[model samples]
Target: MNNHFITLGNLGLCVAASLNAQRLFKDHRAPAAGIFLVVCSAALSVLPATISLDWSSQPAALCADLQWAAEVLSPAMVSFGFLWLSDDHFTAYTLLTGSALLSMLTGWLSRDGLSVMSRCMAMSSLSCSLTVCLFAGNPLGILGSVLLSAPALVGLSGTSPLVSPEAAGGLLKLGLIGAMTVGCWAIRWALEIYVQDLKGWDKSNNILT
Candidate 1:
């Protein structure tokens, strides 16, 4: 019964990806990024179809491990690919998380007409920003990701046409302040790591500095 349900879920995801692609196609002006996103999504959706297959008397431990890798890790790997390509080669903890976030943003931006392209751009920004956040390897990378993500989040909010100009101004102000704070903290964090290294702290333990 569980296997059947899982199969159905996988099919559902495929259908959803198809529908999104179809909608994008119906609109002549859809951005390439949007089409790319849909393609990636469709590919990711197919990963779970293997769950319905029966392995030939595999050990329980191996089965569990395979299941985890397929259901959890596979999607993340696919999303990482999307993010890496989008950013021309980057790192990340989980592209699947970023992809999930992108999916949410796309759903939120489901308005008709010319706004669809804007949604695609916003989705791209979000996916790229999230990829940066997860894979930041240096102080600058971390700071840049934080700064980039703040604007993307704000831009997502701005999608609501009902937002007043005054509110938009205030949001922009807040975003700038927040970004500055993150920059300052990143600098401070870098300095702390530098000091710790000078003190001969173990690199592994001091990594969080």
Candidate 2:
């Protein structure tokens, strides 16, 4: 059952990656760097599953290290990538980058999987959602943002003595995958609406001229 959930989550990541790619290609104005990061993050997130399934012949230590590296890097990469896609300002990018780095360091130092990294992921997801809502002024975008942030928030707050850490981790992973998939689709929807509005404005201006 846990493996099934992981597989589903991986599928969600692939879907999110494809949606991001579609958005990137359809909108030439979209930054390639952000899309590339998102796609790379998605791919990296799935590395553990792939390694476990196909790299049985390889040294276990090597596979474990590779998977650990991917797990550590993926959340930060995806968070920053979404932030960049929503708001392309240098200050915002710098701030997010710094926060991500700090979170990574904190996670490494504490050796707690759920400490700094999960909080950072939640906050970054919220920031991305809020940015999209502000730019597009869409209610659906706001709702989607809440949904995207819900998993991380829940994971942070809902840990209990009754639930095993492994179970919690698995559920959190599933939730994060679903959130990412929803977030990508929501951002794409907002961008499409914003672009259509711009086109309408341009047509109106041309007529007035």
Candidate 3:
């Protein structure tokens, strides 16, 4: 089902980020195993709770789950971001997280900070891997996929700097990412509703036929 895709996407994000952060740590000659456990555990345990117990629709559930997960988790990541990617350049990690946080902000409008934080990290890492691979030229392109390497998945700590002409510019970027994430979910929500209605109509038509 769509839930499977959403789960895969989330897991993929975690794995990818773990990989990237691992590589960064290794290159820097830091301990990688311990940090990886905390990141992976935090993601696995916390991410699932975001899905509403009443989740009923497929696409609706997937998008909502993703958005909510980001909303709950992002702020923490933002606060401690400098620790992970190990830079204050926004690195690809922080840059993508801005978009993930944006997604959460759109959904909750400022409630449940932890849920928002989760969503932010999950979506941000996911986006970073996708974006880097799409654009990066050589090894840098693969740089987005560090967590996949077994060595990179464990022992992790890093940092990064914020990138933007100004705070407002960064906010603008985050806002845009948030809008897009929400917009995609909104479209999926509407589409799912339409499909349900069509299914109802088809069943009725079948009975008549």
lDDT of each: 0.39, 0.53, 0.37
How many Å off is the CA of 62 in candidate 2? 10
Clashing pairs in model 2, backbone N/Cα/C closer than 3 A? none
For residues 26-110, what per-residue lDDT tens digits would candidate 1 score against the true structure?
A: 3211222232333343344334455454444454334333322222222233334334433444443344455455444544545
- Tens digits of per-residue lDDT, candidate 3, 1-209, equal 43444344445445543653455353222213323433453355235546555435664455444433333233223223222322334563455455455554655554334333433454444444334334422232233123221111110110112222353223333343333223223322322333355567789999999
Return the lDDT, model 2, position 206: 100
C-alpha RMSD of each candidate structure in angstroms: 19.6, 5.8, 21.0
The candidates, ranked best first by lDDT, are: 2, 1, 3
Candidate 3: segments with Cα more than 4 A from true spot: 26-42, 45-209
Q: Lowest summed lDDT over 10 consecutive residues: which window, candidate 3?
A: 151-160
**Candidate 1 structure, TM-score to reference:** 0.27
Candidate 3 global TM-score: 0.25
Sorted on TM-score, highest at the top, how do the candidates line up? Answer: 2, 1, 3
Q: What is the lDDT of candidate 1?
A: 0.39
lDDT of each residue in 1-209, candidate 2, tens digit only = 87677676766766675766566565533322333444555565567666656545555444333333323333333344344444555634664566456545643554344445555555665665466557657665566456545544555233223335675558766776566567556645655665566678789999999
Kindly report which residue stretches of model 2 are placed more than 4 angstroms away from their true locations once superposed: 25-91, 94-121, 124-128, 131-135, 150-164, 169-172, 199-209
